[model samples]
Target chain A: MTTLMAWRNLRQDPIRFAATVIGIVFAVVLISLQTGMLLGFMKTSAGLVENAGADVWIMARGTSNVDQSGLLNESAYYRALTVDGVESVARVVIQFSGWKRPDGGMESVILVGFDPRTGMAAPWNIVEGSRDALLAPNAVMVDRLYADKLGVSKLGDRVEIVERMAVIAGFTSGVRTFTQSPYVFTSYNNALRYTNVEHGGASYMLVKAKPGVEPAALAERLGAVLTKEEVLTTSDFASRTRQYWILTTGAGSALIMGAALGGLVGVIIVAQTLYSATVERLAEYATLTAIGAGTGYLNRIVLTQSLIAGGIGFTVAAVIASVLAASSASSPAAVLLPPLAIATIGILTLALCAIASLLAIRKLYTIDPTSVFR
Target chain B: MIQTPESLIVEDAVLTYGKGEFATPALRGVSLTAKPGEVLLIRGPSGSGKTTLLQLMGAMKEPDKGKVSICGTPTTGLSQKRLRAMRLNRIGFVFQFFNLLSSLRAWENIAAPLDIIGMDRGAAEKRAKALLAEFGLADRADHFPKQLSGGQRQRLAVARAIAHDPPVILADEPTAALDTENGQAVAQILRDLAVKEGRIVVLVSHDHRLEPMVDREITIEDGRVVEERGPARPKSNALRSTLSALIEARRAASGDGRGGSGARQEGPRISSLS
Candidate 1:
């Protein structure tokens, strides 16, 4: 009966009800998209390390994250190979370099160098190229997304990395970095020739374990040879990378604060509207109570109305977010709609509405049946 | 005729609002007894505590220092839940404002008390239709309270109050919102419930026109009863005898007006009727 009454009451005033629902929907969509973009950017920041398929990462002593790692001796690769349950280890060099496309457009890019023969640490998701391409002299792979931005075309196109001419042999997918720069993968010797690094030295070591070897235990065993801040599992490396960008940089906090502000504004607007509606219909509620309705009934009615409005608003916002995400998929600030993010935004919006309507619920509970007469 | 016992008895009831220096007495030691098959009229000017007395009798409000019993149960010590149950099951109320749910139709309003008493919707609605038909509101059964006329609303209210067949009916100026004809029609319904069905009917009003419809009239002034008039007209013995003979003739012509002609008459028809 209470549910029925509440549904009837909402139907009684369509405009105000719709306004409340739309307000909530807008809030939900905005929050979800904002949070989704944040997560997407966070993933991009640690994309290489997160999907590197390596059991452990060996960086310089006192290294914070992969992007901030100092130079490490390439000898760390050989030292890791001698450990118990150790497998093949490869040296990986990462450095910022300038790339000049065939069309004469220049842009900053991250150059990743791996061994061509072993191909253990190569770009795993090639879109139009093979790892054997990197075996050729002065050949490199570019990310599919940034290839257009760099004004590069087919695999045979020539480009210059740090003034060293190279052929665009292929492209890799999902290799775009947090800096939104194009990624170029080359042979270790080519990277050394371009960056002028030592022949046996690199910035980090990508270590894969033998079968049945736990990454965490291997990382711990390797930590004794390296420092506590040097050796980390793939998961830890990715986590530290994301944390570095969030804490030291301004991106994470800004997005969160913006979402909070939007939610606060939405709650206040939606709550005040619902409260005013309740006050206007107070006499009707009192009449119901006078006729034998309990406080539980009134509470159910108010909450049901709030939830209905919230559901409508959240749905609208989600649809809007999806449309925006779809249109901006190729953009740097692409909105990603994960199911967990949607659910979280939904729960948050509902909580905001429920909390905002607290005063209205109290007012409903305090309505004296005798006051209707007055 | 079958004589049922009294269902409600109030003794020296005193209800006072506020306390200390602000105490305002609404009912001061007022005593009344309503037997089954009786219409008790409580009449007073505005602010004369007529409403307060009715509220007390209905157990809607408690008297500060007195006892009230309905259907042999003492209401003073009852919990609010118990009082509500008693109101739902044993006492019917018709307010002057009609108090019909604005969202419900005439039939739904009439069936509200029955619903409160836990009757199924189908059964309650069926009873409600019958009651509406009884009150000549069959055509208005599907109309909401806002769509009904003032008289129709009052009739609906009366139908709702009596739908559950409670033992006692407390009406506070049930006909005040209606015109003379509608008011007389409503009064006839109350009279039928009291005299024909043997239910205790207590009506509070300031209208002197309703006095003839009640079996007894009690006039109040400043929260106290000032005059009590019996059902019989004040007349000489010869006049009383002639009136009783006329009433007997009418009863015979009506063929058992009380609906039970096999039972013996207990007392004087009119003088002792009060």
Candidate 2:
């Protein structure tokens, strides 16, 4: 009956009810979209390191993240291979280079050079062709999300990077990085050919530990052999990469601030609407109090009402966010509505509504039962 | 300690609203008692404090001095929670505005008290339906308060107040908003609840038409009881006349006096039927 009363009270004014729900929806949507974009950008920052498919990464000294690393002597690969518990080491080259589109427009792209046979530091997901496609002469792969921006669509399409012509051998998905730059994958030899760098000028060394060997321990041992480079576990590199982008970049700050603002707006709207609703019907609540209804009963009613509004608002926000994620899939800064994000936003919305309800319930405590008689 | 057997009792209750010089008094040394199977009518002018007396009897307020008891339980120092429980189980209130929740239907309004008392929903609804039928409002069971007429609303309020079958029923101007036909009908229900159901029914009203239906009539002016007439006590025209003369003399004196007795302050008051 108390629950019914809550529903009836909200239903008493449909315009107000809709307004409250719209307020919650606005908040939920804003929070979800901003958080989703943040997650997307964070994933982009850590993309190569997180999916490097190696136990450890060896970068030049003073390296903060994958994108900010200096080049190491390619011989560091042989040094890591000679260490105990070392499986196999692959040399990688990452450099920001200019891409010449078919329309003669120039755009910046991160050129990654790895051994296609070992698949180390390669794109994790290929949407168009197999990873083996990189074996073709002068071949490179581009992320599907950034393919249009790079002016390439399908296999056999040709583009030039650093003024060297290359064929689009495959298309990778979800490899778009926070630089909003497309990741173009090529073989180590071809990357060296395009960038005109010496063969020994590898940017990082991807080290795989022997089965059952701890990466940190292996990295520690390899540190002794390759004193010129910094050895880090794959997880450590990924964490540092994510942290660097989140803490040092204005992109991270903007996304975080947007999300926080959305949450604050949502909380204010829900608090104000629920508080006004409570105040409007304060006499009714006091009437219940005078009739011997306990505070628990009244609280449960308000909570039930808030939950109802939150449930509807969350559903609406999730739908809008999902649509946004789908529509922005091809955009440079993709909106990522992961399953976990959806679930988190749902929980957050409900918690916020519950908190907002408390602000309204506080008014109930001040209501004098004698006011009913008045 | 022996306790009064009455369902509702007020013994020399003195209630004041503010403090210091701002300490205006609403009820001054008033007393009231009602036993089971009796309908007591309390009549007072606008500021005579009749509502305060009813509030005290319902355990809704505590007296500054003396005592107000419900079902023989002294309520002066009872905790708010305990008082709420006592009121829930023992007292029913019908307000002047027919304070039915505006959002609820007539029957749902009647069933609210039952729900609060933890009655099963189906049982409460069944009882509410029966009461609506009894009050000739069965057809208006699903109508909201706005859709109901003034009389129907008052009748529904009375039904709601008594829905829990509480031993004490306090109706403050139950019929003030209703027409004569509906006012008499609601009055009859209050009377029947007292006479047939053996509950203590206390009606506070300025409507003289309801005086004849009650088992007793008590009048108050300036927060003081002026007269009481019932089967238990002899009717006295002399007492009424003397109280009226006293009120005139007090009014005349206040005109020439530096400060008037603020006895006519508007608020709820408690008075006794002797």
Strongest candidate by TM-score = 2
In model 1, state the lDDT of residue A277: 77
What TM-score does each of the candidates earn?
A: 0.83, 0.90
User: Per-residue alpha-carbon lDDT of model 2 for B1-274, expressed as tens digits?
Assistant: 1233544778888888888999867788887678666788998887788878887887888999989877667898889999889878777889888878998888899999889989998999998887787777888899999998888888788878877767678888888888887778778878776655556789888898787788788888777788888854333677445434433433344442111222122221111110
Q: Write the per-residue lDDT of candidate 2 for residues A1-374, one digit (tens) a residue.
A: 88788889889889988998898888888888888888887787888988889899999898988876688876887778899998888888888888999889999888898866567988778888877778677899998878778898889987788778999989888677877667888888888887745797788889888899999999999998888789999989988888888878777788788877877887787788888988988888888888898888888888888988889989998998899888988777878888998998899899988988899989888878877775
What local lDDT score does residue A96 receive in model 1, on the 0 to 100 scale? 79
lDDT of 1 by residue, B1-274 (tens): 2222335777788988889899988889888787666788988888788877776677655778788887567789776666656666666777777877776778987776665556788998888897777777788889988888887788788778777666678888888878887788778778766665556789988766788888888888888888988864344677445434533443354352322221212221111000
* Model 1 Cα lDDT, one tens digit per residue, A1-374: 44555666677778888878877776776687778778887887888887666789888777776665677775677778788977878878787788887778789888888866556557868989888878888999987778788877788988888788999888887665777566678888888887856888887788889899999999989988765338889999888888888667888888888788879878887778778878877876765564455566667768777777887788788888878877766765657777788888888888888887787788987776544331
Q: Which residue pairs in candidate 2 collide?
A: B31-B272, B32-B272, B49-B269, B52-B268, B52-B269, B53-B269, B53-B270
Error of 1 at B88 (Å): 4.1
Q: Show what share of the native A-B interface contacts model 1 retains.
A: 0.02
* C-alpha RMSD over true interface residues, each candidate: 3.2, 1.2
DockQ of 2: 0.48
The regions of model 1 sitting more than 4 angstroms off are: A100-106, A115-121, A153-159, A173-176, A247-250, A372-374, B1-6, B77-90, B105-143, B162-165, B193-199, B232-274
